[model samples]
Structures are given as structure tokens and as C-alpha cells.
Target: MRRAFPWLVLFLLCLGLTPVVFAQSQSELDELRREIAELDEKIDAAEAEKSAVAGDLAVAQEEFYEAAEAVDAAQVKVDAVQAEIDTEEVQLAEIELDLDTFKTALAATEKELTETETRVVDQTAELYMATATQAPLVFEFTDTEEIALSSAYVDDALGNSAELAASLEGLRDQADRERVSLAGAREEQQTLLAALDEKRGRLQTEVDALDEVKQVEAAEMGELQALVDGINANIAAAERHKDGLEADSARIEDELARRAARQREEEQQNDGGGGDGGGAPPPGANGWVRPVPGGVSSGFGYRTHPISGARKLHTGLDMSAGCGEPIYAANGGTVVTASWYGGYGNAIIIDHGGGVATLYAHQTSFAVGSGTSVSAGQVVGYVGTTGYSTGCHLHFEVRLSGTPVDPSPYIP
Candidate 1:
């Protein structure tokens, strides 16, 4: 009988463990939750890094694109400058050729004028010397001829005649005029050469300036391209770094989740409280408090996210209700928070005792704020779809410590 009594006691002890195993203690759950929260922080940091990288990438791409455009524009300018230089060079060459041709023509004309002037000078000298030497003889012959009175002497009477003198003077005058004309033409040609040279020099200077501009533009383009390349590299590096952070965060989160799951499993195994959770309800209470009375618009599971258009599992249930519907306190507790939450605009949180908590999200307005105390069924807020939802609804969640659980069991 003593042995049977011990067996009964052990049996009772094992039975008592069912509820204990069903709910983890606040301290142990909080520790595990703290680890999860730390991992969540890591994930958040990783996401922030990733977002920064994305921004860097966008800026880099924009700069790269602008730089590429500038490079192309500079290249076009370089091409244009090259063409202009070529054209100017050709024009300079043509000008030079023209100057040379004109110079050669002037030289030829000068040569002809010099030869003609020399010929005229020689003719005049011969005529002057002949007349001088013959003048004295003529004077002597004229006296003899007058004494002899010959018929041929009459023709010789007109020695050093006006016609010969006049012709000599006229020839000299023509040579002088030819010399003046040739000299003047040579001076004109020289003036033209000087003008052409000046023009050519200016053109050359312009070409040089264009060349310099091209070099500067090309260099600037190269530098900008390098900057763009560096920025792109930085963006890539930042992206990789951000990805690493995200992966690290994910690993930590996975490890935390795995540890938590293992702990939960171990607790379940030690107390033989696996999936079976049916038990006697808490006594002295009419029933479980309804968190918020509303029709279920969406249940827990996969659903299309309204904003992201992504297929994601709904972590909790969505309650269908009108906008500004008076939201009630799920259970008697203090308000943990009532504020806007990301993707859950105008949210409220209620903390029940023993680490039990409830979240009401997508509220049009709030009736309470953080630190406010309230009883069950007290109006806490108004309900509406404010973020990441298709219609007016309340996103409700039940958690033990920081871990989510099915709300249906506690609701009824």
C-alpha cells in the first residue's frame, strides 16, 4: 500500500506538470525573448544598412550616368575640334600656297622690269657716247663739207638731232616708270604677305586654343568618369557590406528562434504536454474576455500583403469593423502603448498580468495612452484599417512575454 501511494503521488505530480509545461514562466520566457529581441535589433540594423546602400547605389548610378553623358559630350566636342583644326590647317595651307604664288609672280615681274631697265640704260649710254665722240668730228667735217659743198653733207648736217635726244629721254622715262610700277607691285605683294601671315597666325592661335580646350575637357571628363567609377565601387562595396549585415542578423535570428523552439520542445517533453492543450478553464471567471468584438475578416495564415503586394503569412487575425469603432480592452490591464506603429497606424497595446499581452492595430483614434489603466471591456480605441491593409480592420495579436500564440484558445 505504501508503494501504491508513492505511485499515486508521482502520477499526481506528473499530472500537475501539464499546466506548468503548457505555460512557460515569465523569467525564462523573458530571457528567451530578450535574445530574440537582440536578434531583431541586429536585423533592424542590417535593414538600415541595406537601405543606405540602396541610396548610395542610386546616387552612384545617377552620377555614373551623368558622367557617361558628359564623356560622350566631350568626345563629340573633341571630334568637332579636330575637324575644325583640320579645316583650319587646310585653309592655312591654301593661304600659304596663294601667297607663294603671288610672290613668285611678283618676282617674275620684277625680273622682267630689271632686264628692261638695264637694256634701256645701255641703249641710252651708247647713244650718248656715240653722239659725244661724233659731235666734235661733225663740227670739223661740217666746216670741210661747207668748203667742199657735197650733196651727202646736207643729210649729215643734222647731227645730234632732236628726234634722237627726245627718243633717248623718252626711253629713260619709260624705264623709270616701269621700275616704279614694279617696286610698287612688290611692296603691295609684301603687304599682302604680311596680312596673310597675320591672319594665318590668328587662325593658328585659335586652333591651339581649341586644342587646349579639348585637352581640358577630355581630362575633366576622365576625372568625372573616375569619380563615377569610384562611387559605383563604393556602392557595390556598401551593398555587399549591407548584405553581410543582413545575413548576420538573419543567422542570429535563426539561432535565437532555434534555441527558443528547442527550449519549448524540451519543456513540452519533460512535462508530456506536446500539442494537447485541452484543460479545465480558469475558475471564478464568467469566460475569457473578448479582446475586441468584431467579425473576422482575415484569419491567421498566408495572405497577400496590401502594400507590398507580397505573399506573406498573417501572423495574427484581422478583425473586420467600421472606422472609429470603439475598441475595448481585451483583458484588465494597463496600456503598454497607444501610438502609431509602422504598418499599423494608430496602434494600442495592453499588458495583462503574468506576461500576457494583446495588441490592437489599425485604429482610427485612441481612447487611452501608455500607462493608462483599464478594466476588461473598457473602450480603449477606435478601429480602422490605417496601414498595410485592404479595408477597415483591426489587427489583433496575443503574446506570452514576446512570443506570439494562437489567440482563439484564450479568447473564448
Candidate 2:
């Protein structure tokens, strides 16, 4: 229902009713007022529904802003967690490179140790065979020549052999120590790498969760923004309707003023003595009667608006009448307006001579049409809760040359 307001506003604005001429009769004037009133009704409806939606739109916009902020915060956390993961990965890569280097060194140390052991085994075997051969010669030799020859061979063979055996033993021990140290270093690197991998995994999990949260918040923000846009469009439609209604009302009022002026001029020319035309009930005069048989519910003056809660002139006296109750004319006059009249729903306006007029508003239906001359206490309409009224009642006003005055002075 709310979405259709914009199209309705456009259609009404395009109507472009013909302009009113000065010589148009009271019936033509009433038709114009009715048309304007119908337009006003549409405008008022659009305005009436806007208040609730506008409030909703405000709340939605606020939520959207909060959601957007939450998304941004979540993104920040995700980025931080990802950064930590990246740092851990880099450390892990370094540890892997160090492990590879340590393995290479261990392979070379083991190969050198194996070669040294092989050389030591070969030297030990040569020494044992020489000792065995020389032992037999020692037992057989009683001559000094044999003894000397055996001794010379032993010394020559024994030269630096013991020292070489000692040096090989030291080399083997050094290789064993290096292997232990390398193994420990590799183990330490592996342990550190495992810890970093675990930390990175945790950070990655955190980042994934934060990303999901951010996506949800962003989606919510998008929905709220769409709602706000829709509400703004509704408000725009209402504003357009209001503008059209004002334009039409101004035209009607100007026409009424013109007609009133013309009537007064003609009356003055005919009287020639500048008589009062037997019009305009003086102060404390008994020229007008009550329009409705009810007590006053509200008196005319400045008061708080019931619907809008703004300070404005009440503009009329509210008579406590029930729905369908007959509304009488305040005095005898021609009906200048008997149609929907802006905030005064289903209104009737009677024009008495001497610039005095009376209005009755918020009627369910009209008893008489425009240009109809009605006598005092004549039923012009039935009470209704139309226009700006809260219930079935008659809004009575007395105007002097189109400006509303206190109806009390004219009603007695």
C-alpha cells in the first residue's frame, strides 16, 4: 500500500485541471473545491502513513551503521591473525633449511669415520703378522748376525705405527661427538618447527572464523540499507503529494476571494446609499444559530495538534456530535463550497453578504450541493470523523473575508 504512493502522486500532479475564471458560478466554484479536496485527501493519506515508516527507517539506518563497523573490526582481526600465521610459516621454512644442512654434514662425518676405521684395521693386521714372523727368528737366532738383522727389521717396521694408531683413535672419538651434537641440533630444529606449525594452524582457524563473521555483518548492513532507501522513497512521494495539494488549495482560495469582491461591488452599486446589505451580524447580535445541537468539545485557539504534536491554530470550534447527526447552517446564505475541503473533510461553506461566511466540517455526507440557498437551521450535512478529526464531530468556523475568526461571536 505504501509503495503505491509515488505513482498516485505522479498521476494526480499530471491532471492539470483548467484554470478558474472570475465569472464562474457558485456551482463551478464548488466543483473546483471538491476536486482540490480530493487531491488533498490523497496527500493527507500519504503523509499520515509516513510517520511510522520514517521511524523504522531511522532505526534501520542506525543498525546498518553498527553492522558496518563490526565488519570492519572483524576484518582487522582476520588480518592480524593471518599476519601471525605468515610469520610462523617463515620461521618454519628457516628451520627446514637448517635441518637439511645438518643432515648433509652428518653424512660427510660418518663417511670420514668409516674410512679411518678401515685404515686402522689394515695397519693392525700388518703389525700382528710382523710380530709373529720376528718371534720365530728370535727363538732360532743364537748368532749375533741373525739377532742384529731381526732387531733392525723390527725397528724399521715399528717406526710411527703406534703414533698412527693413537691418532686414528682420537679421530674416531671426535666424529662420534660431532654426530651426537648434530643429532641434538636436528632434533631441536624439528621440535621448534612443530610448535610453529601448531601456532600457525591456530591463527589460520581464528582468521577463518573472523572472516565468516565479517561476511554475516556485511550482509546485514546491506539489508538495512535497502530498507532505508525504500523508506526515503516513500517520504519523497508524500512530500510531492503535499506540494500538489497546497497549489490547488491556493488557487481555490484566490477564486473565492475574487467572487466575494465582485459580489460586494455589485451590491454597493445597486444600493447607491452604501447600505450594509442586511448582512454581518454585529457583536452581541442574534443573527446566527448554532450549526449543530451539541456542546463544544474544543474551542477555537492555538493548541497542540493531536496527530502531529505540533503547535498550531485549531482554527475552529469542535462540536460534540455523533456520526450521522444532522449539521445545520448558521444563517441563510448561498452554499459556495459543499465538498471535501482539505483538513475539513466533507465540508460546507455558506457565503452571507457583507464579507461574512460560515463553515461546517468533518461531515459524513452533504445534505445540499453547491449554489443552493439554505435558510438558518437547515441540514447541510451529517457529522463524521473526516479530515483531521479524531471522532464524529462538527468543526465550526466563522470567516470574515476568508480569514477564520472565533465562531462564538457569530453563533449566538
Best by TM-score: 2
Error of 1 at 296 (Å): 32
Q: What local distance difference test score does each model get? A: 0.57, 0.65
lDDT of 2 by residue, 359-402 (tens): 88876666678999887777677676656666677899999998
Give TM per candidate.
0.35, 0.50
Q: Candidate 1's residue-wise lDDT over 1-412, tens digit each?
A: 0011122232223222111111223233323323333333334444454455455545545655665565566556556656655665665566566657656765665566566556655655666556557656544666766455333332343342445445546655665676566556556655655665565566556556555655554554464445445435444444444444334433443444455457646866898863222222232264455655666777877888755556987777887677545667767788988875756656888898899888998665566679998776676775655444455668898889888776766665
- Collision count for each candidate, in order: 0, 0
TM-score of 1: 0.35
Task: Name the runs in model 1 displaced over 4 angstroms.
Answer: 1-163, 268-412
